[model samples]
Target chain A: MTTSVSPVRGSRDASARSGLLASRRFVSVLGWSCLVSMALLVWLGLSVAPTDAVQKDAQRLMYVHVPAAWLAYLAFGVTAACSALYLWPRTRSLHYDRLAGASAEIGVLFTALTLALGSIWGRPVWGTWWTWDARLVTTAILFFLYLGYLALRRVPDDPQVRARRSAIAALVAVVDVPIVHFSVSWWRTLHQEGTVFGEDRDAQLDATMAWILLWAVVTFTLVYLFLVLRRYDLAGIEEAADERQLERAIVERRSEAASSVVAAPEPVSVAVGAAPGSAP
Target chain B: MTDAAYVIGGWGLTAGAIGVYALLLQRRLRRAVRSLPPEERPPWA
Candidate 1:
């Protein structure tokens, strides 16, 4: 008889018995909606939006770059909030720990996108592939900080110890987000002030461009929503599986000890029961 | 690179990054569901 360890849905909650990602229909609906929104986003950004007065076609990069940056910030924000919740005595739960880990991983993905798109845009406008500008430097730091957070999560430790350490690390790393956002204004840099939120209207995008940019932001935000949901669901399942495996190992070890104490020689192959093995 | 090239590359890479990440999530979700015990497995999964 083969027993497979499936991912965790809290058996504790009867209402949630179907599991966290049980809504396949909901995911399908969301997936279709995301496809339509993305098609519209590309159309508006690539076909309808007017060429910039200065940067010309290169300005189109703004559509994707800004949204990616928005998601990076949003992802990290969720991680920090969830980490805080996990650490709080009143709201402590492994669910929040899993959520924080998932969000951080997604955040790292978007941060890399933000940086890469920024570099691609910079090459044509700034005549360079890279720059040590304050915003760029700070964003780079933000990337590595979360990367570190992800690494910390992988370290072998007791669940409580790992979660506590990761929570503190996540909170500390989030301090860099504000610094990255404000870096353009606070220091002399090649990067210009934000187009959407700039104080100078003259420096901002026109009505048509603004509308398209708004749509782009909405589309990407929806994309972020879709990705985070799936990622968080996976995290929940993975943690549940890990907990089950740990429990199994403990049981096996106890059984082995009991048999040994009785001077009963167990089959050597039976001792392999606690070893980590893949599911069939 | 031409301005048009930059635009195409920017959007392409952004889309690629997002698409790859979504695919990776789906793959992991599948594996996780498989690892679960029959009794604990989500019906939808």
Candidate 2:
């Protein structure tokens, strides 16, 4: 004896249940972790960390700004790697294409955040809101380059064509990342070189503040990972919808063609002599 | 503006930007999941 099961009900049940952290549970865990870590970071960064001798309270902005800049680099790096995987013949797959697109989008968001935070941090420290410094200019260029890459992905085309072209564009655009990173050193610039990894390797930040900064970086990385996962899942669902829509259109067009092919009597025949027995 | 004001503004902007983006993403995911048929809905949705 077989029992009938409602697929909708089963799906809702499965979705509601909490799975292992490797799958569905990751979303909830990551969301809660981001919230908790962010709160802790704010407290540690603002209240606990000692104010800088020169920059004072404004130095606190470094915690978020630096992490954001790092996350941007990380996201773009992921995009480039995924794009390469998608482009290579052996490992080419739609999964890599979607992952590349997702990472690039998140990268753009973080890049925008990095720029804004840098400006905010700069206004008090650097005595200017905007500058054409090497670091700032390179970062801005990086942002726009990825923005253009995203626009390329949106142009209506076959999936494979879009993926192939955008993969190349992603690779091209990622070249700005290292330039942005080394811009402070590459030119006479208003932005200071990295204190942690500068030519003078002695770190400027004290232990507590340094630890908080490190924690913030890790927290932001987790947040970036969470966002990328969610974005990738959304891409899959949206792509599936597109595929279904295309399938429906094909079926509709086939039906319309079939109806059009149905035979019709000649107009001059007058319905085949009035059905052969009607009143003349 | 004071340095404290700048710090607060930067932190606030970070929180707000991330919060808004997450909310928007959740909405988009829900919409996409709903558009697909029951049989086609992703298990994680």
Candidate 3:
């Protein structure tokens, strides 16, 4: 949650510290574009794209799985970058921490989707649901690493302390993303080598399939942008609500203390040498 | 399972997961908005 927030109504920015794309109009446009493009992508991927001569219908899984993995990387990259901003003294702000948390949460979701879709595809292509191959294992490790990052954020503590700890953890967890990507190349494994962004950077994939894959990636990126914007907005409002609650509680406690002091009887006084029944 | 089944399953799972998350986020935002004074609520809320 951002501290020192400006009213969001008719505001160009989300808050005093909002990022460049935090405008309400921009987010709304992006949401509409995401929905339309995603529909187009789905129709083309399922109906228009040519079936693989080898993998048959199972090849369709590539349209979603690759993009999902791409989103996982993109989301985590945003998290790490934002976390760095939070860690830097000059750029330090709670906005970056909330943004990082939002990105990491989306990253974890996409990672799960990637793993699940990959498993679904593997059943037909690799003839197994899962294997202990380097790529699969490394990807699993990356998933858990981010899961740990999210769990760390939930531990009750000072907001700044939590942000610092989460920022460091995000930077550390991001190291595995590259490892997962390169695992297919670094070691001999059951997983196939990357066709597009691999060591050779070959564009050897079929033309129709490649086009559809590219469209899917574009569509998913739009969807990610929309989701992140909405998530950031949600974070802002939720934090505001939390602060309001805290303030209300403080007021209630102060009033209760004041009333108790007022309600107390006056202190009785008597001369030390005087008897109980005698007057001073 | 058939190839068609897996394909459908993968796509369905993606949609379902994302749809559920978006819906839940909307619910949380609405609840939060209700808790705050009108002046403090975000435009999107």
Best by TM-score: 2
- Give Cα-based local distance difference scores for all models: 0.82, 0.84, 0.83
Compute each candidate's TM-score over C-alphas. Answer: 0.87, 0.90, 0.89
Q: Taking the tens digit of each residue's C-alpha lDDT, what string does model 2 give over A1-280?
A: 1111111211223222111113667677888999999999999999999999989999999999999999999999999998998888777766677789889999999999999999999999988899888899899999999999999999989777898999999999999999998888779888888956666777866888889999999999989988988888788678777777877898999999887666444554674567867776
Question: In candidate 3, which residue pairs get closer than 3 Å at backbone N, Cα or C atoms, i.e. clash?
Answer: none
Taking chain B only, the TM-score of every model is 0.92, 0.92, 0.86
- Candidate 1's DockQ is 0.71
Q: Candidate 3 residues A133-203, lDDT tens each?
A: 99999999999999999999989786678889999999999999999988988999998888555576768
RMSD (CA, Å), candidate 2 to true, equals: 6.4
Regions of model 3 farther than 4 Å from truth? A1-21, A264-280
True contacts kept of each: 0.94, 0.81, 0.75
After superposing candidate 1 on the true structure, give the runs of residues whose Cα lies further than 4 Å from its correct spot: A1-22, A200-203, A264-280
DockQ, all candidates in order: 0.71, 0.61, 0.65
Docking class of 1: medium
Sort order, TM-score high to low: 2, 3, 1
